[model samples]
Target chain A: MATETTQVNVLTAEDVLKNWQGHRRVTRRTIEAFPEDKLFQFSVGGMRPFSEMAWEFIRMAVPIVDGVTTGKWEEYKGSKPETKSELLRLWDVQTAALDEKFWKIPPHRFSEVDKAFGQWEMPGQATIQYAIDNEIHHRGQGYVYLRALGIAPPHFWERD
Target chain B: MATETTQVNVLTAEDVLKNWQGHRRVTRRTIEAFPEDKLFQFSVGGMRPFSEMAWEFIRMAVPIVDGVTTGKWEEYKGSKPETKSELLRLWDVQTAALDEKFWKIPPHRFSEVDKAFGQWEMPGQATIQYAIDNEIHHRGQGYVYLRALGIAPPHFWERD
Candidate 1:
């Protein structure tokens, strides 16, 4: 059978930038919904704690993005804060930087490959994409934890 | 500051069944790796083409489940087809039945809802969570479509 590959239209750097920005907005809102007490909760003994997952969310982004652009696991020199509020503040700052800087990415750069987590070889675009998608994935777990604790997270229906 | 009021989770019974079934390994294998022509090519626009939105694997399951449980829709009531030659034929049949059955779901029964879809009046779960997460959700879309097209998807790196 002749296969039809659905090519995602080549989006402008600006469009991709907007998409990342939109993801950030939703992420921040999700952060705002969390109560402090449950920050470290993990649904199972084996899974990453929510607090740890939140930190993982932070650690994963810069190195992943750096890997894509630089093609190596660059030393991530950013300071890790001690509290969730500080983490959230740093998150907002870094994501804002992404929104502002992501548009400057050249279109020809999509094929650039980089090492993620200092181990895996992945595309630069994949790193950034993982940054966005990973949050949605884990934030999902956050919802499960929230429900278990009787704290409702934001509704998925309404958009900011 | 206007605190964002928590939102409700509104999903039809149809949404629930499709989501659960869509995540099945057999279903994932069938939908994600179908021929691109068959997988990406579909009859709708604005809506994801079947091949592209492998994430929508849940579409067929939701409506069929809803119809069977609620007795409200007629979309899934046709005589079952007997033979299957191509990769997507079974996938198509199941999805179509579910879609038809979705229309049959009664409005009043939405309160009872599916475990996966949750309820329509609470801020407890996200529609996208129920819509995407409970089903194939994140890793399912292009990944499975690629598989359906005979390209192997990336292995779960964390999995041993």
Candidate 2:
């Protein structure tokens, strides 16, 4: 039998945005739970500190939203925040920008393949999934760091 | 103007399975890189060891595929493997099972909502995303575990 192909409605654009935002909420709380000294300085098995990973997120997410309007990626030129609080402030600013622009993406665009950030060439929805997946993956490291530092990390299911 | 409601075909069911399987490949490699004693015994900030988290993955994934066909979630009753090799064997077996059964899910079923394992009520596609998302989240902790052990982690994007 020839392999079958059927178009499937996996998720709505709204559902996608909500899930992404929900996870962002959880990751922000995970950062707040970290001790400042350790958050900036600690490394496990040679991975960078959570503070470093946090920057990757801000850099990546801002592009996802900005690319929606520009379709051209701009390298993050802002200086890296030296402290965790400053990191959170930058994150909040990007979050607000995402909230404003994400809804404007017309539904048909999600299925169209586009080059993201000048390198990634994938469907729009896949790019969005990448943002969420990348965050969840990094925050998991933060949890391990917190546990190592004797702090209880936020529960995985608590995305509020 | 009333906002449009279109059931966009963002990802085909096959694409979903391929992505989930790809991540599993990366996660399995992550497990192999961990030292045996630390895999089971090490916990930072009081989180359970990577071994315990591995069990959660097995428990969750098998049910997701099995429940897809049987509509009944079977609690994983297999004895927990104490050694990493045995754990890999169990994972491979489950991977085989998932590979076979995952395709049996009709494409349209993905849009239907059901109580997965009689607990989670969500669209079938979202349930699959849950399985993938959960694995990515936990494997991140495994990365931290390896880093803390002074071992190099398998790169995040390597999935074969």
Candidate 3:
């Protein structure tokens, strides 16, 4: 005879939001560290400039959040901002939108699956995490670009 | 009056694991792109070498996984590997350890809070995502380092 058991989790819904925001804050700082000229012009190891990567973030994130909030998948092609400030402004819009709408999704919603933007049939949480993950990865490239130009990047661990 | 409604998500536990592994594969490839001499010596903007960042990943990941499986928190301070091969070998060790133990954790365990390494009192899942996020962020740095050195890094999106 064999006995079976199930383990329950202790993580609360609030933790996810806090964790995501911490990383988000640090990522924004990374963006601010980039000089205006370098944001669009810099590339290291044949990688795209930070601007292109930022555009990718905008392209994927806004729609994902909108889809999650409204359950309507809308595909988007970003209006690539030519200036770094415009890029930041766009980023701010998305950030505010998430803050307003992310909670509209109940905690359990994170664990559910969805085909975001007509692609990536993954859990709701996975798509959101992917958005954060994408930004962090690209910021790493931005840090490198700044360093190559002899500019110091914001410390990696900071959330502000 | 506005009616409150709960949103349903489409993601699942299996998707989380798959997504985590996909990012892990690409990050490992990023490590392989580093040249030996530059692995420890290269830095842009006063950042630690990519090897050191890789060491941070190894230090954090092995313990977090071990803690999840064994229910014991152990802190580690990595003795920096002098060579890239040694670093990769240690990384493989941790990867194997993760494969063996990660599934031992039932899905609910992800939502449980654990003070990883006796610090970072976060949900087990958040800690794991942090590990993945950390690697992706630093790998971006590795890509930049490679490009600055005139080396072509592995494609950013490839997991294979």
True contacts kept of 1: 0.01
Candidate 2 overall lDDT versus native: 0.78
Please give the CA lDDT of all the candidate structures: 0.47, 0.78, 0.71
lDDT of 1: 0.47
TM-scores across all candidates? 0.52, 0.88, 0.78
- Name the candidate, 1 or 2, with the larger lDDT value: 2
Question: Per-candidate DockQ versus the true complex?
Answer: 0.05, 0.54, 0.36
Task: Give candidate 3's error at residue B155 in angstroms.
Answer: 3.4
Worst 10 residues of 1 chain A by lDDT: A1-10
Higher lDDT: candidate 2 or 3? Answer: 2
Candidate 3, residues A90-124, lDDT tens digits: the string is 88887787666666765555666788877778667
Docking class of 3: acceptable
The digit string of per-residue lDDT tens for model 1 on B52-116 reads 33334335355434533453333333433222233356565555654554444443433333333
Candidate 1 lDDT tens digits, A48-146 = 556766677777766655455445566657776666688788888778666544444444444455566666665555456456556655665555555
Highest DockQ model number: 2
Candidate 1 Cα outliers beyond 4 Å, as residue runs: A1-5, A8-12, A157-159, B1-57, B60-160
Local accuracy of candidate 2 as per-residue lDDT tens digits, A1-160: 1145234445666667777888888888987888888889986767789998888888888677666545666877789998889988988988887777776666666766888877888877778778888899999888777877778878777666
lDDT of 3 at A60: 75
DockQ value of candidate 1 = 0.05
Please identify which of the two predictions, 1 or 2, would achieve the higher DockQ against the true structure.
Answer: 2
Interface RMSD of 1: 17.8
Please tell me which model should have the higher TM-score, number 1 or number 2. 2
